[model samples]
Target: MVQQRLFGLIFALVCGLLAFGSVNAGTDGVTAKQAQEAEFELGKRLFTKTAVPACALCHTLRDAGSEGAVGPVLDEIKPDADRVSKALRNGLGNMPAFKTLGEAEIKALARYVSQASGGAGPSGN
Candidate 1:
């Protein structure tokens, strides 16, 4: 009877482990590089389409294929992530504040711009 209980406990433990593994299976295969790429892609999408008026409408970014004449050329300026975040949140010069975007969205956009323009530090907002 004790052996049967032990076997049952082990079986339960194994089943629980299997269930947990399956639950995390989708994320277990993703590499750090893949996650970073996904983040960059998300930022690109926000820049081109999700943001109000769209960053592509006023910013010139070769990576995004935008040829806007209003904003400064990102390739030349290469503003860092913090600068981009500040400008996005509070507005800078002719740019309007993007109050609609959340902190995560701002961070992603900042990272994307900083990286794409060869700016230093893709750090947080």
Candidate 2:
């Protein structure tokens, strides 16, 4: 009877730990998702802001709901993350280099564009 009680106690402890771990994991998952959503919103803001000749100014993106006619249509081009990052970093064609945007901003923008364009991240993330 003592052994059975001990076993029951152990089982209860283990179950409690497992439940606690599960709750912690769920919280972490929610936090990570919230952070990602915030990053996406920031990228969208960067893409649409006028302070830096917004990406939306020249490109048409369905996800961004942009209908710009100056540059290529981003929805049709469907640029990968790397291409978007490279262009943001080094500029392309008639586009001038945007050395002012921080690296994190550039990465966020690249990720946003890749995901919005219906492609995976730069290298499938």
Candidate 3:
């Protein structure tokens, strides 16, 4: 149990770090497998649907089956829940604010982007 918690913590921390560039990253530990899957599901919904200005219209994540290159490749960004949340909340460089999205959905998007990256836990600056 302790080991699981520790691994979760590490995963959360890594996700946060990668997602936000360590800029006031918050609320990690959202790494349960089920949660991750749910996040992926939500992300897919957001990506394909136009209701919330689908991500596919701008960015690309091959795993999500999108090839858009308008914005940075989401899969390459390596964002996690917190980092993803911050971006949605703040509207980074060119990605407009998705402030209407609730925290859960935003976190789900983060998880979706990070996991889809097909990469290990967050690393680097």
In model 1, what lDDT does residue 75 have?
A: 91
Off by over 4 Å in 2: 1-30
Candidate 2 residues 13-119, lDDT tens each?
Answer: 44345446642536544344544565576568778763177888888999888998888888888888899889988989977777766665676688788788876
How well is each residue in 40-115 modelled by candidate 1, as lDDT tens digits? Answer: 7657877887788689999999999999999999999999999999999999999999987766567668888989
lDDT of 3: 0.62
Instruction: Name the better of 1 and 3 by TM-score.
Output: 1
Q: Which residue runs does candidate 1 get wrong by more than 4 Å?
A: 1-27, 123-125
RMSD of candidates 1 onward, in order = 14.5, 15.9, 10.8
TM-scores vs. true structure, each candidate: 0.74, 0.72, 0.61
Candidate 3 Cα deviation (angstroms), residue 27: 29
lDDT of 3 by residue, 3-113 (tens): 423444544555555566553324443434444564467666666563267888888888778887788887777666567667788998988998666554565566567
Q: By lDDT, who's the top model here? A: 1
Off by over 4 Å in 3: 1-35, 119-125
lDDT of 2: 0.70
